[model samples]
Target: MCDTTPKTPIWKAIADALRSDLAEGRYTPGDKLPTEAALAERFGVNRHTVRHGISALVEEGLVRTRRGAGAFVAAIPTDYPIGQRVRFHENLIAAGRRPEKQILDVEERAATDGEAKALVINTGDPVCAYHGLSLADGQPIAVFESVFPLSRLAGMASALQDTSSVTEALRALGVNDYTRATTRLTAVRARATHALHLQVSEGDPLLRTSSVNIGEDGQAVEYGRTWFAGDRITLTLES
Candidate 1:
């Protein structure tokens, strides 16, 4: 003789299946899930069962349903730490996200007034400008620009192109180490280009950071600004 416990409910099975997909990164933040009809077919259940299962996800804040559109995965803000020694890859790795960058532009340019002030250089002095977008698990999260005094960091552009890492590039230029000497954070609205690059609405909130990095000799090595998607990052200050 054989005995069996009551089988799991079909709706709960659907919910559990979808939850696993979300947890394993199959569907990232802001991604649309399968339509109710599609899910119902896949699960071999009725639409009612599918809707009931999805409702559990909505209640748990893992997914949101739009009246006419569809269910979408909810965004969970990634934790970012602000401190003297800040490394983008390290921070994202610690948060369990794959970090990546798309270098948009890099060139030697005349330092503007703001750049001069931040880098302690005269206006019109040559500077290496590096621009890029940062992504977390394939989601655009921030756009950044870093300016370096070209006279001090010769061939900076080539180094950045080779490494795509500020720390490694600076090291190639003979700057052994550096630390953040100043950090000024402000809340701002995304501009047209920023909005386009970050896939956010124009005028959406953005977290802006203006910072300067100093080398072991206490000389300014980098002047940088980063605009982060307001809804995608939770910045924390480390004491």
Candidate 2:
């Protein structure tokens, strides 16, 4: 029998008790949790304490509550990192899931001002734009739109359908020599496409990364923007 004793802050103790119960399969994912009043009675705490415990779980992304209904377990989040140059397939494999891609748009067009600056190419330079969603275990996790200099990477658009990996595609194009090169990150709300792909509420927290891959000669080869669901990914950077 598990101890029901409370030894720490009342809220944490309550939260831990609930966490343990959920982990023990007393309640499964998507199971509607007991009401705050009922939980307070079970834990011998006040209603406010039960609310705090549930709030903790919500913050941890363990459970979600629907107004006018009740709280329920949230599906486990998949861990992904942002501060690296690893291919999407590699990252998901490391995290124990099969990776997949849904190509959205793959075509060549003249670079826009932003793409031109990011890739360090002259405005109107031909660029191959590839837009897709990166998925793991069939769940969409990221939306990517990357542009590569068509002048530099001839036939890249054709190459990428077979290999969406920026690194691998670059290698096949004789531009194998590239570096993490440059990266800028910001917290954003999941915009139109990302919101749809990630299935999160519009404006949910997101990790937005803009990166440019450059060759050894200081030439930018690719510029990409990626949005990762905050709940599904963790970004780690080490020196």
Candidate 3:
């Protein structure tokens, strides 16, 4: 008797081949893939089959399709650790990627109820707010808003204006060190502001982190919220 096992579909085979190529670094992140017609000609298949293969890659988060720009390799998510001492630049550097921070806005605002609770301050107390973008290898990874008690860190705004690093800014204001005291994470849909900042469409997935940092004296020094692009970062809990 002859074996009668079914064979894999050509489109699935194509997708497998592309996935292998990606794993082998045949195409780097952000590289545009061949056009559908070109792939079809190369694989001896129809355009519809090529489209199906591309769709599979999209579902697997290995490729992204633009309306007129064809498919492009998706960026591999960076592993970002959440720990007592979390430094964005140090983390990216350890991952062999360049890190950058862009300070978007800075202002002094009255603390909201949540902010006051996180920072252990009065609800109407003034706080210095810093809004910024964090990037790895030129791609936006997260948008962050950090609030500090103005009475404690009066020069935080000026320090932030001079440098993009929040740690450095705090250090400049005589805070030698701070550690993460608490963190809460949730999955959320990107809003208009977040989408614009992260270069993603509205309703795209985002990882939201709300955290509090404390000084050696065990007093809350900062309250921060960060919205990470879902496809660009993998959050890790560190011991």
* After superposition, candidate 3 runs with Cα above 4 Å error: 1-26, 32-50, 65-71
Name the weakest run of 10 consecutive residues (lDDT summed) in model 1: 63-72
Model 3: number of backbone collisions: 0
Clashing pairs in 2: none
lDDT of 2 by residue, 12-58 (tens): 98889989999899987556899998999998989998999999999
Q: How much is 232 displaced in model 3, in angstroms?
A: 2.0
Task: Give one digit per residue, the lDDT tens place, for model 1 in 1-239.
Answer: 67787899999999999999998999989898999999989999999999999999989979866555788787789999999999999999999999999999999989999999999999999999999999998888999999999979989999999988999999998999999999999999999899889877678789999999999999999999999988789999986
TM-scores of the models, in the given order? 0.76, 0.71, 0.82
Q: In order, what lDDT does every prediction score?
A: 0.93, 0.81, 0.91
- Residue-by-residue lDDT tens digits, candidate 3, 132-171: 9999998888999999999898888899999988888989
List ranges where model 2 is wrong by over 4 Å. 1-60, 64-84
Once fitted onto the true fold, the runs of candidate 1 whose alpha carbons sit more than 4 angstroms away are: 1-26, 33-72
Write down the RMSD of all candidates, one decimal each: 6.2, 6.3, 3.7
